[model samples]
Target: MVLVSAVRDYISRMLQDISGMKVLILDSHTVSIVSVAYSQSELLQKEVFLVELVDSISKSRESMSHLKAVYFLAPTSENIQYLRRHLVAPRFGEYHLFFSNILKDTQIHILADSDEHEVVQQLQEFYADFVASDPYHFTLNMPSNHIYMLPAVVDHSNLQRFSDRVVDGIAAVFLALKRRPVIRYQRTSDIAKRIAQETAVSTVVYSK
Candidate 1:
């Protein structure tokens, strides 16, 4: 099976176990992730009637405790903040969190810390971190394209962000295949080398 298919299977398993009407809540990045692989029609088939961004969903005070919320989002700080706010005043009957990649212990602690209402039911890593634009190829879809041309000293944090996303994409590819790969990056390309190293390091850590 392909990377996209693996992620699809993980999602299918996540939703199939939960019976009844569901609302698929996604973060800004995951909208494309779920939309491309799982269409609106397909989601409807699975009884998912609503698709809303996490931030926007939190803004509306309208309570819809009738529907179960399945959250597929990156384990980003902003998403965590949004989850914290929602736990205080939950609109859905239950919440199932599926992070695209490995979540930090601090992140899990934050979610647990915020979940005083005990609305969150599950937390898992589904490994659909990259946007699958086509069957053979995928893109990290990093927002800042200009980072590669600049030196690391110019913007250390942005460079880290760019590298982290690329590494995440590469890790998702291998995790989907369920295989350990020996990946190489262009030596001349600083960004590629850094990303490759980070990917290898993260893969080792995760696999262990």
Candidate 2:
């Protein structure tokens, strides 16, 4: 029920089922997610021989067909595209894909089409998508946390991105814990109101 333990358990489940030497792959965001709860030594003890970024792994021409690829990535379009390219030219014996959040149906179809060789052993949404600071607290780790104080018009795109990250982070937390939150935010703050509204929509979108 605690934040760190929940994240740790999800990661344990992801790695424990797949046997043998494996390469743990992570995206920029997922690196934070995993690093907070799972240590490098823990990964090595689990038979993880290597850890590489999603964008970095695709650039290597050398094949690791002897190793099973264990991917822990955020379910973003860019990450999916990188994965699709890897699937098109599989370099591993088997691929176990675990997304940090829900994967849309269209995204699934794209992956299906790109997987011509069908080396993908599994594809699932594990939902360990937030950075847990401790047992009781978590964070999205947004550097632009200050933007919520400024009006949205000051920097529209950055504010939008910030809000979206908040929504995603909130929804991911609820999804990971399998709980529906009863949200209450400050009614006076426009930014808090905006986030509460977006979280409502996003939680609904991802919960199903």
Kindly list the per-residue Cα lDDT of model 2 for residues 8-49, writing each as its tens digit. 988898899899999999998999989989899999889998
Q: TM-score of each candidate?
A: 0.93, 0.92
**Please, what are the lDDT tens digits per residue for candidate 1 over residues 1-208?**
3756876787797788878899898988888877778877888888998889998888799989999999999989888899888888888999988888888899899888888889899989867888877776777777667656555546678777767777887888777767787988778778878887888887777777
Off by more than 4 A, model 1: 143-146, 149-153
lDDT of 1 at 173: 77
lDDT of 1 at 137: 71
Residue 101, candidate 2: how far off, in angstroms? Answer: 0.7
TM-score of 2: 0.92
Backbone clash total for model 2 is: 0
**Candidate 1 collision pairs:** none
lDDT of residue 8 for candidate 1: 77
